[model samples]
Target: MLVPLTRQKFEQLIPRIATGDQYRYVWGKFSDFLRRLLASVVAVVVVLLLRWLLGEGFGGLLLPFGVVGGFYWLWGPVLWASLRNAQYRKYKYSGFFRGRILDVYISEELIGREETVNNKGELVYVDNLERRLNVEVGDETGFSIQVQVPLRRSHKGIARRQVAEMIVLSNRADLSNITKVTDIYIPSRDIWVSDYPFLQRDVFVEVSNRIRRDRLESEEESPRTPRRPPQRKEPPQLPRQDREW
Candidate 1:
């Protein structure tokens, strides 16, 4: 099942973006404030010592402190939230897809390399393994797409034949080859699986109920027709996607 992205969905999505795990807040709460304060205190001591060693007074200290401190404390959260808001706006005009899981499994590959220094102080390259929670989903059209998520410990419970849904943000209008996808929603279980929490739980659940209700009403209004299961074909082989999560 699929629906074109609607204005209502976009409106609902905007408020939820800040609540997502991807949206980083520099000092969100009391604990956050304490943590930053502690770090800042240590940093201030270091800066003061350096200024004294360099024969610099308050004027020189203020410039470096203001520039570095303001960037780390103030600009970071604003920039991060702005980017997340922009991301939701882009996906707002995309396609929404509801489907059943055809297959679910894990696929691991060398996604990249990490640089680290060994005990001897020599830099060495370490292979960064990318493990994906690969879920193959299909709708009535028999067109299947493999939704790959960066596998996390929580996703070990995913199995075959679960009802799944996502917002498809693809380069192609057909949405056959999705370049970006929101987190998979399993409404029956009231669970979401994603490397990052992209949607607000309560709002998403509300949207899910509306979609399911609409689907049920549509089916009932139409005359009974023989339904065929989506063909059990191998998941399509697609190129590596550059996903943020």
Candidate 2:
């Protein structure tokens, strides 16, 4: 089913960006590590208890396998969440740029379920579809970046060559080495897409106004000759002899 990007949906879409609390950004990595460590300790205790009840022969055989599986289940998601949080934080500190959409396209990828050997040694087919919205944005400096919008079926109607703005991270002020695009705004469609849920409508409007103001300012600053008002022509002087009056 198609879903619009509401506040709730936005949070669900990017949990790492919506850390449980604001301060989590500062301590999130350590917090996640401690959580996984605590889970590992609990898992060890449970496994030991099971081994004591079941005896060494079977229990010992299960210990290695259990530890491996437990570690994966406990730490895998934590590691992934940490990485996502870090990425989001990086993007938050990046610089903002005004950009326009040069192109847009949809990419479709087919994913297949893992093959398993059934009792009859036959293969079962299970396929899934993954769709992505890719947009190319160009800044005034002539630098272009491609951003992948986390949109599903609802964005099928988006078109190419739309006006857009982006937040990007670059190594230098000249923006020669852009690393990523954190957000995008298409003013014409009133659509704002970002890596996080912080892209509000008010903020989008503010940014749009800023871009327009900057453009006006730049045009004003460029060298342009001011037009001089036409000088009024002096009426022809009355004939000097006309002073006969």
Candidate 3:
């Protein structure tokens, strides 16, 4: 029973997606390398078996090459999807933290170039855009943390200096692990406000108040003007004495 993935399913799955840092860890890198190596080995073995069975015929010579090429082309995306599904299952049982975003910026990186068949049945190269939302968020105790959320190039409405109530999840076994932002609430954005009606007005009020207090404290801590030294008074000169000498 195969169910078609719809937009609703994709939206539900977004929160469960793992952070990029998770994929960059040593073990993560090793796992990725292992997957590629295994895929390549399997592809080669399958191609050899086809050649042996078909014995150098037109199908054996041509089909084996096609099979190997297709396997290599689809391996990356298939591997990523498997990793994401595993991560989502783990995140479903994790605890969530509440925090407010203090700042945000977009970080762009080139993952790789992709090839797709055009309408004319010719392959074309396209750049794969990987944009991440690097956010600095603070908890109630003023302890701040940075987290990166993967974003599509077409995603809009997120800007620097926007405040967001973030719901973050972490790996319990590894407390120092990178946190995943499961959900976010931006009071300043009308679209978000309308989308999340359950968010109370007091939540926005509290966040706004905290932001103002932090700004005022930062301004007060700025360097102040130094006071000028008092001037010394000179003794009055003796009355001009006529040259009595």
Candidate 4:
């Protein structure tokens, strides 16, 4: 069974993650950080520009706008960090761990779902997102974990991002529930090749046949019948009679 990491562990782990881990673009962390930093800088620059352009007369109005903009810049990250921390706290706790982390994993979660109409209106069933872990573990029976990192949506507009996943493995060898930090791998550091490869696009187009295959098959299956052969006509009767005579 696979489970998400807990809040406390997430908080604890975030600080310990290698600086390299903070650079991963998969989760959009770095991009968000830069955005916030840029917003703050822009706010300051705006104030300076106003001061130079309008002098002391407009300072009163401009300062307030700059301050408000600065707050806006700070607000997003605070909300994100807080929500993530809350998610972790709910799962990791005193009774959860049967062991410690043996390995770490990371992969794209392939999303799939079915939509159906029911008495409760329309219901959506999301199958488990297909997950691919980056590493193998010896034992993963019972252990609590936490993951602290940037969310994927945060990087939608940015060119780069930092993403992460956390896993905690437990040792089930002894009946006595004792946990140890056997091994921990960082999920945030895996740099995704953000550059779109042209080959992949080409392969997709080649394999799918550009939607023409279905049209061609449909045409073949519904072929029109050939027109009946034109009726044969008697040779010119007058000419034939003249020859006979």
Give the number of the best model, judged by lDDT: 1
TM-score, every prediction: 0.61, 0.50, 0.35, 0.25
Itemize residue pairs with steric clashes in candidate 3: none
Model 3: residue 152 alpha-carbon error in angstroms: 8.0
Among these predictions, the greatest TM-score belongs to: 1
Error of 1 at 160 (Å): 1.9
* Better lDDT candidate (3, 4): 3
* Residue-level lDDT tens digits of model 3 in 81-185: 446545544542232233456777778867799999999999999988787767676654445667565664433676655655543334543223435543455
Tens-digit lDDT track for model 2 on 153-237?
Answer: 5565567777776545444444346675555767787676553433334544664575467557877999998899989876543
**How do the residues 1-245 of candidate 1 rate in per-residue lDDT, one tens digit apiece?**
66655556645654533553554533367776566666666666766766677765665656678456634544445556656656655642455567788998888978899899999999999998888888887765676777677777767667778888776665554555666667788766655766545555576667667866766786799998798998888765432222111
Judged by whole-model lDDT over C-alpha atoms, candidate 2 comes out at 0.55
Model 4 gets an lDDT of 0.39
User: Which TM-score value belongs to model 4?
Assistant: 0.25
Model 2 lDDT, residue 211, Cα = 48
Tally clashing residue pairs in candidate 2: 0
Per-residue error (Å), model 1, residue 186: 1.7
Candidates by TM-score, descending order: 1, 2, 3, 4
- Candidate 2 stretches with Cα past 4 Å from truth are 1-83, 88-93, 116-121, 139-141, 150-153, 194-205, 214-245
RMSD of 3: 21.7
Candidate 1: stretches off by over 4 Å: 14-17, 24-71, 74-78, 111-125, 170-179, 221-245
Q: How many Å off is the CA of 121 in candidate 2?
A: 5.5
lDDT scores of the candidates, listed in order: 0.65, 0.55, 0.49, 0.39
What TM-score does model 2 achieve against the real structure? 0.50
